[model samples]
Structures are given as structure tokens and as C-alpha cells.
Target: YPAAPQRFSCFGFDDVNAALAAMRFIHASTPPTELYLRVYQLESRQLPRRSELRPPVRSSPCDCGFVGNQDDEDENFLAIARAMEEIVDDRVDCYWLIRCFVNQFKHKFGDSIPHL
Candidate 1:
């Protein structure tokens, strides 16, 4: 299993272990606000920004397309996130990791990518 934040909590036996591991990682690091377990599911992926997961427009056709792309992005982010979670401990916080990733992305896709 990947070592990221969790969601769909309250699963059967297997999930408890995942959550326990994740909690251990989170506990050691500086805690954040509104950064729920589900979000950890996201952080585990090593994404640059949380806003990218939010929707720009609600109840629209374009929303669907955006969702599909976001899912793919999320999956990729999770891979790196999970890997980092495995090694990183109290010294680093998820915020710094997220900001660093996001800034780097902004730098690379500057002027070309939309506000992400």
C-alpha cells in the first residue's frame, strides 16, 4: 500500500494499519488546519497544491473534463507522495512539501499553464 493520507476511513482491518502508519507520520510533523485525513490521501501523493483539487466551476459540462484530468494528476501525485511519506519524518511538514512541489510546477509551466 502507498503511504499517503487516508480517506474512506473506517474500513476493515487492513485499512486500520494504513491509517495508523499515516497517523504516525502526521503526528511527528507540524499539524495543519482543514487538512483532513482525506486530504492526506492527497498529500500522500506529493501534489504541489491543494487548490488544484478544487473545482473552478460547479455544475458545468467542463467540470467533468477537468475532473478526469485532475484524477490522472492526482494519481501521479499520489505515487510520489506515497514514496516521500515512507521516508520523511518529523523534520518535514506536508505544507512545505506541497508548496515546494507547487512552486516548482509553476516555474516550469510559467506563462503557459493556467493559474494552478
Candidate 2:
């Protein structure tokens, strides 16, 4: 069967800052309990370079263990993997999980996102 048609409203702005401002205004006026913002770039431009005169450094031949132990990092990653496995085992929809994560991220970092 053909996919169901999707309808969405699109707004254009001269720059990202303008778009973000519009979004903030809309969000404040009609504050939805749940909302997700997805921004897409219509055009791309090469950024101007400031300075470039550094040569690549070569690695030493001797084996040196400069890096510290990563057991804690590894355990943390393993714990996350286990939790994800459990969620999958519960048959949670992947799209729902992604949407939940995106909403959480927006709630946590929405204000700071424009800086990034």
C-alpha cells in the first residue's frame, strides 16, 4: 500500500537565528505539552578559514601507555547497552524511543542549542 500523505507547515527565514526566534514565539504563544522541532538547512556555504599553517605530527615508534584506564567508561557503556537490550526485549517501538529521546534532549538543551 502507498504511504499515507503527511501534512506539515513550513516557514522560511533569512537565517537560523530568525527561524529560532519565530519558533520560540510560537512555542510561547501556544505552548504544547509535547513538541519537537526539526530544522533543515536549505543551503550550505563554505566557511572562511582563519589560520592554517600546522603540519601533521608523526607518532613515536616506541609503545607508550600514555592513556589512563578506561574501565569506568567501558562499564558505563556496557550498562547503557544492557538497558537498551532490555528495552528492545520489551518490544518498545524504535520510533517512539527515538521521539522520546529527542523530546528529552530538546527540553534539556533547547535554549543552548542556538549557540551550538
Candidate 3:
């Protein structure tokens, strides 16, 4: 993670041993807000389609097709985050979080193109 105020509770590692280090950082008395376990190759292969995931429209109720109303859309995301936090100890799944981030990016800037 970064440092101090900018330090993130979430972590990403390419191997199992690094992930084990992260586990030790978490204390039973005061666990992190969330944890994420990711295999870069696997997630790269299963990237979510940009068109299928878009940001919630705060202005127009029907602009975003995922939910009928804006309030419901916000609630849904909060619920998902809460669920992820609850399962941090059991399993750290970063797929959904990464997908959501990509979707938000694409929603603002059309399709994403990788650059070497």
C-alpha cells in the first residue's frame, strides 16, 4: 500500500506467499475493512464487458439501465461493498471490484484499449 493517510487496506499480490504476509498484517482484534485475493492472469482473462457495466446516472432516473431508480442503484452498490467487507476473512475476491472499476472507467470514456 501507499503510506499513512493514503495507505490502502486492500492489497494485491501475484503469488500466494505475498498474500500470506498480508494475512499476518491483519489482527483478529482489528481487522482491515476489506481484503482482496487476485490472480492477475485469471482476472485478465475474465474482464467484464464495458458495455455490460456502466456507472449509475445521478441526474436521470432512466439514463442508467441497471436500476429503475437512482436511489436503488446507490443502495445496491453499498450492499455489494458491505457483503465484500463481511467476507474479507473468508475469501478476498477482487474480480467484482476490478470489474466495477473498469466499468466506471469505460462508462466515462467509451471502450478501453490496452497499450504496451
Candidate 4:
């Protein structure tokens, strides 16, 4: 059978912050009892000039170890990585919030959505 016609709804925003605010609103509408929802935020950035100036070196494991532990730079990067991980762990709810929004749209539209 021919694939059912799909209807898509797009809410364009001037910037990411506005989109995030809308996501939070949708997340708030989700039922409190629901759990295990998944969401993700994919971000990208241009290479920084400082990084370009640094010498290329093999990456070391995040754990404290003697290998590649030749300088303070390694320790600094490890600390930064740990801090970033903590931030991501805390923001996991943001993903769920966005998921809730998508689910709501799906439910409201029913068969109109097949692959959001």
C-alpha cells in the first residue's frame, strides 16, 4: 500500500533559546507519572583558534593515569571534560521535555505523523 500521507508542522524560531522555551512548555504539559522519555540536543561549534595553536597529540583517557600525563594541559582537559559530562547529565530532562512536545504533537495529529 502507498505510504499514508504525512502532515508536518514546523514552528520556526529566530534562535535556539526561543525553541528551548517552547520545549520546556511542552514538557511541563506531560503527565507527571510518565518516565523514561528520551531527548537530545545536538550542538556544533567552529574550531577555536587556541585549539589550532596547540600541538596535535593523542587523547588520553578521562581517568587519572600516568600515560599522556606529561603536563597540566592534560589535567585541565580532563577536568573540563568531567565538568561538561556533569552538565549534560543534569540537562537530560531538557531532552525529555522536547520528546514530550513531539509526542504531544503526534497524539494531537494521530495518523498524520509516521516518522517525526
Top candidate when judged by lDDT against the true structure: 1
Could you give the C-alpha RMSD of every candidate to the true structure, in order shown?
Answer: 13.4, 16.9, 14.7, 19.5
Better of 2 and 4 by lDDT: 4
Write model 3 residue lDDT over 1-116, tens digit each, in one string. 34532222234332432543454532344222222221321344532233543333234322333333434434333444455565544233433464465457447643322210
Which pairs clash inside model 3? none
Error of 1 at 25 (Å): 19
> What TM-scores do the predictions have?
0.32, 0.23, 0.25, 0.20
Return the clash pairs for model 1, or none: 4-44, 5-40, 5-41, 44-81, 45-77, 45-78, 45-81, 46-81
Better of 2 and 4 by TM-score: 2
lDDT of 4 at 92: 36
Whole-model Cα lDDT of every candidate shown, in order: 0.40, 0.30, 0.37, 0.33
TM-score, candidate number 2:
0.23
Ranking 1 against 2 by TM-score, winner: 1
Q: Write candidate 1's Cα lDDT for 37-93 as tens digits.
A: 334344456433434434222232223121235454444344434444555663235
What's the lDDT for residue 76 in model 2? 26
Residue 60 Cα positional deviation in candidate 3, in Å, after optimal superposition: 26
Candidate 2 global lDDT: 0.30
Local distance difference test, candidate 3: 0.37
Which of 1 and 4 is the better model by lDDT?
A: 1
**Which predicted model would earn the best TM-score?**
1
Rank list by lDDT:
1, 3, 4, 2
Worst 10 residues of 2 by lDDT: 33-42
